[model samples]
Target: MSAESKPLSGLRVLVPRGGTWGELVSKALREQGASTVIAPLVDFGHTSEEDKLVDALHRLEAGDFQWMTATSATVVDVLAHHQAVIPKHTEVAVVGEATLQAFEAAGYEVARTPQDGDNTTEGLLKVWPEIETDEVLKVLTLRSDVAKPVLTEGLISRGHDVTQVVAFRTVGVPASVHIREDVQSGRINALLIASPAIAREVAKQFPDIPENTIVACVGPHTHEAAIDSGVKHTAEHVESDMKHALIETVESVIDQSDMLD
Candidate 1:
């Protein structure tokens, strides 16, 4: 390493997930000389309205909707549970490549994937499927329980009939004692806030996070969520994609040795 290298040297960050994902993020941070603390702060739970979602899945298999929107990877798991089938003619709109990968993992094909980075209601709306006829589109939205009805509402305003179903719920998971202690003690230089719920949890659990620790969100929506969650410090958007957002944020803030006076 050059003398001016390792901008993130001495920086310790907290990444919210572990296992393969954690390892991947840790590897990236280690290259930047930042030690990463792997602790997942949230987990996906069953949708609040199981029966409604189950019936929606049945209708999906029956070709009731012309298009179905998958806002997150967890929706793919719901399809797996019901052994859902998508007719060849039915258009499946995925939020992003991650969601597309989830569908493929669950043995489904994606007909349309969001092209933009903000892979949610706004992104899907930008790549809205074309309708050849005057008939209103029949759309099914499978989303998280806490997810706002942005897509459904937007489609409705566009004169489409949408049947929105809750695919899953997000539950908060407590961080390990060592993790919390490190965070509060300000040893952690940054905190990667992946979701709105995670932002809320951080606000609740780690109220005394270091003043200089970076609080970075994946994209604009999550940035808003962090603001809404009332994180005491300013929150910033590091990248549109989750995979590289944390690393990008750390690089932006870390002190560069070459800049030393």
Candidate 2:
């Protein structure tokens, strides 16, 4: 498509996370005529509880747990790094499309994903009881160091035996000087907030953002987190679509901005 015919033409958008997921989002944005800056705000590292994580993986391979939960793509990366295997008897569950895509890419067969498009822990929990026939199951819930125990706690409250393991620790990455300057000066037209951690990094790195710049968050929870973290956004002026459809969400916001202009 020609630049003038594109919806996001002349717009610059920031993609927070790196690796396979980042590349996919960046490619989608570029196709819509948006120039993307892939400055990853967070990186994953080995968890401090190495022994516990190893034991959990060993038991997972042994098919001790009836179900395994992966909340993020980073969890799938940790599993791939450990060369872990999901036995035939154990079912795999995930929260969002990104996690589902990561599992599929890693050659892991997922047995469950949110069907209602909620794509959050609450969404997964909502369908868990209906999909799972077993009354008492041993669930292995893998999560990041900073992740809340909402899934684990919900499972336990539902009378399931749960073993929650810290898969990896989230580490913050500093943005380059040029990227920081562009953001502060409003050279970048928009910023994408995929997670609360990335939102926190945005707040820490760029304390003062230009009011003209648009900040698009992937979901409702993320939008709340961004505002709570003092990340300036355009939500006040526009009714934005809250979905994990990152490219579509960006286009929706840009369209709103056009109408306002």
Candidate 3:
């Protein structure tokens, strides 16, 4: 493959997740001439366990909560299902601008957001001190089942009454026949994994991708998951955002593949 020929001209890319973030990555790969296949390895849905979240909202209405944290846009979607509006008194803290936009679209305002950095638990905690905790400080965390307890533990360490509510659950989608065929036939040249859950599901479905297949991840958490799942060759941190990370990873892989050929 020459520079004129390009590295990803005939490459097939597999996107194991489906969401606004995943769509962004897919679009970028298509623009680069990669045959993008969306297998949607994970599905997110609101669970029937809303009583705890409803009770938390009641507490927020009673002015018991000081801050509410939403780690992902899916969290905002699940939260909106229970409460029509988030209490104006309770400060909203989120991880990404997309999450903040979702909150705002749902008629809530975000007080703090991690614009820079890895957008991980540690990044959110660095801005935690700015929040006042003179009162009981109810910290309601709307998250998925696969979410880590790091944020909750950090808030507790800061003397806040942290209540983590499982707003949504991540269900693994079995790999489709087409995806299986693509993998078995060695058509997929790269795998773009954005979430840890997706990485786990991919590992389960295609236990051994072709040795030439490139493994690219969005952030440190996903990278750790990929490594744990036995994905040997991984891309470095491109950006905290999923779309940019995928784009950069694809470009890098294309460059490397071109060099090798």
Candidate 4:
């Protein structure tokens, strides 16, 4: 394809998902002709905390919990690694389809999931009360270090004994010299913030991004973080999911730039 025909030709985008997720976003951006940079803001690794997770599994098998929630697919993987089992009687809820799929693959039935408009905590809360309250509901929440407390706090407010576990830690990856050089030289046109954690890390590493660069956040939370960090132009995905939102935001940015020409 000619350079002019390429969707993101002459644009450079940075993706900071911090692991396999970053790779997925990077690959998609590259296919669209955006020079992609992968700078993970966190790293995932197994830790001795598996014991606590194992204990949680025991609680699950004993039918001690009424509901289980997973925020990330990585949490599901960590649960599986510890051989966590979901009791047949326990209901499961997840933030995204990928997490639901992971639960299904692990032989658990998903009781609730966020639909098109309900991908946020507020969206999930609309249907949360429908769950039986008399059943001594113990909610096992699996997440990373920097997860939002909204979900767990909400569950607790509704009379659920919520056990929130940090399934993994988010550690920043040391940026390569090339990434720093490109970013400082104003070659990076836009930075895609997939999560609030990544956005915070980016703000810490590069306190002063070029004035002309655009900031596209995957969701409201990340968008807020970007704004808090003093990013001038910020956009949130109409759709809640990261992949779709990132692609749509990138396309929108490209279209708007073309219109200005």
TM-scores, one per candidate: 0.71, 0.78, 0.70, 0.66
For candidate 4, write residues 105-207 as lDDT tens digits.
Answer: 7677888866554565556777765544565577888776666666788888877789987677666666677777777678876777666666766787776
Regions of model 3 farther than 4 Å from truth? 1-11, 27-35, 45-50, 58-64, 105-107, 132-136, 217-261
Give the distance in Å from residue 109's predicted Cα in candidate 3 to where it truly belongs.
2.5
lDDT for 212 (candidate 4): 62
Q: What's the lDDT of the predicted structure labeled candidate 3?
A: 0.66
**Where does candidate 2 stray beyond 4 Å?**
1-7, 126-135, 218-261
Which candidate ranks first by TM-score, i.e. highest?
A: 2
Q: What are the clash counts of all predictions, listed in order?
A: 0, 0, 0, 0
Candidate closer to the true structure by TM-score (higher is better), 2 or 3 = 2
lDDT of each: 0.67, 0.76, 0.66, 0.64
Report lDDT (Cα) of residue 20, candidate 4: 34
Better of 1 and 2 by lDDT: 2
TM-score winner between 1 and 4, please give it: 1
Candidate 2, 146-198: lDDT as tens digits: 77777888888888889999888888899999999999988987888777778
| lDDT winner | 2
